[model samples]
Target: MTVRAAQRQVVTERLAGHLLASGLSRTSVRQLAAAAGISDRMLLYYFRDKAEALGEAMGHVAAQLGGRLEAALPAGRRMPPERLLAEAARIATEPEVRPFMALWMEVIAAAARGEAPYAGIASEVTT
Candidate 1:
């Protein structure tokens, strides 16, 4: 990969960690850039826009959450949708998973408000 791509990945991962820890409450370009230890202009240079940056970060969070869930409940273990949701709820209570759940709630609230990035991200999560 190019040096620029690698640097973008590092910044994206830092943004993902920040999002998981703090949710989407403070996601201005400056705030996100600060979280990623980059200048706001550099963040824009790395990503197309704030939506793109946030989408990539939340996608990372979702992937992390999926991996944690798969570890706790391995694949090919089938259950009814309701039962699966219950199991997920139980798993969400675990400390490691709780932050993701909190972020999910924030995403849902943002989606409900018809917010950009989040509405799209929440749809990606649900569907």
Candidate 2:
């Protein structure tokens, strides 16, 4: 990836981590950018705006969770439905996953309310 792309990835990951730890409603992009040692202008430049940044961050979180799920799936094993359900339940109940779920739900709700940028992310998630 180009340096700028790498930087945006890092920023997105940091923002995801922050949102996961603090919950979505409480986070400010400016505060998160400062905490990540990035300039507000750089954050805007990378993401276009706070809403887009938040959507990108949510996408990052979703990709990470999907990776984890794929990795945790049994390989060449004939798992029973109950076992598969249990595994899914375990993943869903993980503490680390909780924040991402919260953020996703909040973003979707915001999108429903006509929140800009978030609508795109919510649509992405739904698709």
Candidate 3:
């Protein structure tokens, strides 16, 4: 990835971490940028707006979760319903994955409030 893309990923991950630690449902771009130790205008330059940045960040977390699920699937076979359900339960309840779940929920709530950037991300995660 390009340096800019890498920087965005770092910022997004930090923002998600901050939200999880603060138990916040949403965050302003300025607030996130401040917490991420970057200029607010830098955040705006990388992401059209707060919602887009948050969505991209949440997408990174979701991709990680998806990778875990893919690894857990049985080799050369579709994952059975039972296995899927068990994995879902594990992810939902596991402390390690809590931040990701929190970020996912936050993004979904944002999308519900007509946040266009997060709308597609929320749908993708639900499916």
- The prediction achieving the highest lDDT against the true structure is 1
**Candidate 1 lDDT by residue in tens digits, 31-61:** 9999999999999999999999998888888
TM-score of predicted model 3? 0.72
Full-model lDDT for every candidate: 0.90, 0.79, 0.74
Q: Candidate 3 at residue 91, lDDT?
A: 66
TM-score-based ranking: 1, 2, 3
Residue 15 accuracy (lDDT) in model 1: 96
lDDT per residue as tens, model 2, 1-127: 9999998989998888877777656557678787557988888889888877877777778888778778888468779999999988898888867776777778878888997767887888667
For candidate 3, write residues 1-127 as lDDT tens digits.
Answer: 9999889878888876676666344467778888788999999978898867766666666777777666766458667799878877886778877776777777778788987767886886667
| Deviating ranges (above 4 Å) for candidate 1 | 79-86
Clashing pairs in 3: none
- Which prediction has the highest TM-score against the true structure? 1
* Superposition error at 36 for model 3 (Å): 1.6
For candidate 2, the 10 contiguous residues with the lowest summed lDDT are 21-30
